[model samples]
Target: MSGIHLAYDLSFTHTEGRWNQPGAWVGSDFPDVKMFLELARTAERAGVDMLFFGDGSGIPSTWRGSIEPAVEWGIQWPRQDMSPIIAAMSTVTDHIGFGLTYSSTFMHPFYVARLLNSLDHVSGGRIAFNVVASSRGADAANYGYAQLADHDQRYERMEEFIAVCRALWDSVSPDAIERDRATGRFADPAKVHPIDHTGEFFTVKGPLSAVPSPQHHPVVVQAGNSPRGVAASATFADLVFGFGGSLAGQQRHRAMLDAALVDEGRDPAAVGILWATQVIVGRTAAEAITRRDTVLDFWTHEAVGTMLSHNAGYDFSTLPESFRLGELREEIIAANASPAGFIGALVTELGADTVITRDEFFEHGFLAASGLDHTVIGDAATVAETLEQNHADTGARGGFMLSSPLAMPSAYAELSELLVPELRRRGALAPRYPGSTLRENLAV
Candidate 1:
């Protein structure tokens, strides 16, 4: 089996320390650039595969309300841009891959291709693209659209968008440049092909402005679990991100993705699977539990209600907290009939009693076990052992994308000091990066 590909989902605007706090955005703090560089270096030393950013173009008014209330009530908030920070981080770390999230819905394919190509060059082929079709309705308006595109339509546009980008990358071959200074000739025009791509969503005239990077193209990653989302990923994604309440559930998702990939005429083995996880580890299980509970206690019912309302796009505040689970599912179905089926499936699996009220849901959501397939809160060796079992049982391509509940740097520091060394001793972690590019690291 392949080794675990560990990664940190860094938020430029949503800093790591406020992860468990409702309405807390990590990126807002503008954590010292030096701090980010050091953290990247730490992950590298700890044998992480990549340090990635989760981003959005605009904040919705609903979320803004939550933030304002939290601020007035003396709560924490985080926000920051991830692209330039990763670029800076790359200069300070040797082998770790850096990823930036860019929405396919807002940006042009030509611009995205050129920007990422330059980043790949600057980072020496250690860059990746986390493609997203923006979820927030306000974000679309901010970008000059009257309303956000429907979820399925966004995926349709993304399909054509990615195809064009790939073609643009192929347009300018690496060897196209001649650089004959004496003759005042630079590149071989004949070698640089014109894409002349015309598609349903996008049209490009010629080759990309920038040359292809050493990695050839940045690795493409997708993070969505809906049916349309699965189809989009199956067609182009190199990695798929999934969320589940149990190991069996995660395995089911993996099977679904594999089937989708096979349908696309792509080898399932070529794509990697990463589960999102939040781990709180300490010297003892008791210590870990205490820490986890402390974070959960900070989350209030109002905060959770606000967060969920924004996510579901229906005001849950007006609804009764004592609303029955069946009633809530029906309400959700009425509001967004598309994802209702998936939501209903989750509620059924977790059971009505297990699902919490709007207020309780926010607090419960912070609990590692509530959302993650595997939650490790114990001694280092025990944590490492559980990870090994998970890998063996599921045959997942990689490990979790670690989420820090609080103090991003400190959480990672603990991971480095406690978890990493033990994993190495047990031969579950890599002592050094196996290759130079993100593709090579993930593929291996």
Candidate 2:
């Protein structure tokens, strides 16, 4: 394994009350490009592998079937298409790779492929595409779907989506661009060929009309923790994004993914899992604990409900006052929603037959929505040691994806400044920026 790889999950930097947190979003508002520009520089200087942004295009409206709570509380709303933001960030920092997410469920593969090719050229091959089969009903509504596609069907689409993208990326041979200035000949007809792709989901013809970027195919990243999802990741993902909430869950995911990789005729050790771990670091453990407490003050019932229901793609507000855990999972799966989220985790912890009250469910949801449950908080050394242990337990293949519930710029500064340096000093991190393109730099 290539030591430990660290990436900052810039996905929700301004969401879930983080903007109002101390040391976060001080001067800039959400979608402020300048904030990202400065952040990119800080992360790159700290030798962070990549900066990631997760996307969901619609407002969160799953709570009681209204958009009010999400809008009022700013629960995972106001997300921008980070493609341009990433392009702008690339210009300011040359080495840091950027992860931009797009949904395979909502978008056409051709548009996404062409757009990523241009961004790859812009960033000098420093772009990673996080292809997702979107799960939220709110997102589906925005895309004009009355309901989400079946869970298994979504993964099916995702595999085909990557297949189409790869074919498109390979359509134009690297030698296709023969710019002979002396002869004024700019042609290589034999090298350029049509993809002529006709699949269950997409249909396209002809070669991609663009020069190949430094890395012909951008690094493909996927985060799918369900059994079907894990199978799909084993098939296409260059890097797997796993939740860091539970070590046992992560271990299971790694083992399942390894077996799936073997079945796919791929090497499991070659793929790494970047666990999405939230953190709050201070000079001292007490200070970090204080910062962690601040998360408790921000969530309310409506806010918690919105956050939980939107992600599950089922309305938690509709849940009865008392229900069995198995019943909830059944309902979620029956609705064509996700069964492997917090509910699945709860099932693993408490037996599936265990009954939970409405209050109890939202109580758990509060900690999750606020990011306090999975957050690792302490002094740099303590936090670093926790990461080391977790990495080793989870196969030590990929590293942690550090996220913060504190403010941006400052919170990220603490991570880049205090935490990463500690890991390097301990010799616990992989070589920093050791390659040219992201595909090489982040390889495990």
Candidate 3:
């Protein structure tokens, strides 16, 4: 085995009251470049592979048709572009790569390709693009849509989006530029050619008007939980972001992806799935549990509802006193919202025929929204053991994308300073920065 690769998820560093939690930045705040600068240096020192930022452009307004609950509670709201953040982080560190997400459903292929191309240059070939199909109605509304694009249709658009990007990236050959200072000659015109692309969703013309980035094309990362989503990942993703909440689910996802990769005529061994895991590691077991308790006690009913609604793209606040699980799932599906989150799980677990009360639904929603049910909380040794067991239990292909419920620097510090070192001491980690670019290092 080549060993495991790890990345830190900075997607929710300052949100959900994390800024008020212990070990959060005292002087600096969210969007403050200084805190991130320190984090980049720390991450590089620890030999962490990547720092990832998942993005959602719109504020949460799906809960009760208002964004108040999310705004007041800071639930997944107040996010920055992170492109600039990655650029800043790259200047202060080397070796460690950066991953940032963009929506293929909402964004133009040419723009996204050009932007990532430049970012790959800025990061010295360390940039990875996590392309997503937008599902949230709030996100769609921001892009001048009343609701989301149909689920499968979004994936179709994503395919074309990627096709256009690939063509643009390849349009300019890596050796096209000729910087002969003595002759004063420019790029070779023959090497730089136009890509005339017309597809179902997008029509992009041209070779990208920029020098080839360090890697030429940024590493592609995708996270699609559904069968269709998995198929899409097999098509283009260099790395896959998967949910690490359940061992059975993780194993299932791995199996499905392996099959898909084979079907795509790609080597399954070359692709890896970085399980998205929430962690609350500490110096000791007792300390970890105490932090977990803090997490358990953090969410209010409104906050929980807002997060659940925003993510699933369904308003849970409007649920009646009691309803059939199947009916609720069907309603969400009819509305074109995702039928695969909290409600989907309920239907799966308790049977679609089961009747569940609103209170019982929220009871589940609390755990679902806070992500406590899926989180791994323990000291370094215990956490390491759990991870190793999980890695083996699954395929041990990719490692983990660790996110924190506690405040930034504090929770992140525990993973980098404590958990990661433990993993390294146990010889469970892959080589550190073994390759020049993200594609080389992260591609299993």
Top candidate on TM-score is 2
Q: lDDT by residue for model 2 over 1-444, one digit each (tens)? A: 357898889888888888888877655787999999999999999999999999899898888989998888888978988888999999999888999999999999889889999999999999999999888888899879999899999999999989998998999899888899999889788888899989898888957878888889999999999999999999999999998787888999999999999999999999999998999999999999898888877788888888888888889888889999999999999999888877788888788989999888887888777777689999999999999989888998989888998887799999999999998899999998889999999883
Where does model 2 exceed 4 Å of error?
none
Ten-residue region with minimum lDDT total, candidate 2: 21-30
Residues 1-444 of candidate 1: C-alpha lDDT, one tens digit per residue: 767777776642232225434334345434568768778888888888888787755543344344464344323234456677888998988789987888898989998889899989888889888888765554566689765667688889888888888998899888988889999898988879889998878889978888779887889888766778888999999887666347776777788788999999998877877776666778787877776665655445555544444445445556656555666766654543234223444465666556456555444433321322245667777878887787666674766676656555667777777887787888875436768887787773
TM-score of each: 0.87, 0.98, 0.97
Give each model's whole-structure lDDT. 0.69, 0.89, 0.88
* lDDT preference between candidates 2 and 3, better one: 2
Candidate 1 positional error at 267, Å? 1.3
How does model 2 score by TM-score? 0.98
- lDDT of residue 276 for candidate 1: 66
lDDT-superior candidate, 1 or 3: 3
**Ranked by lDDT, top first:** 2, 3, 1
lDDT of 3 by residue, 183-299 (tens): 999888999998988788887779898888998878889998788898999998889999867687788889999999999999988888888888889889999998888776679
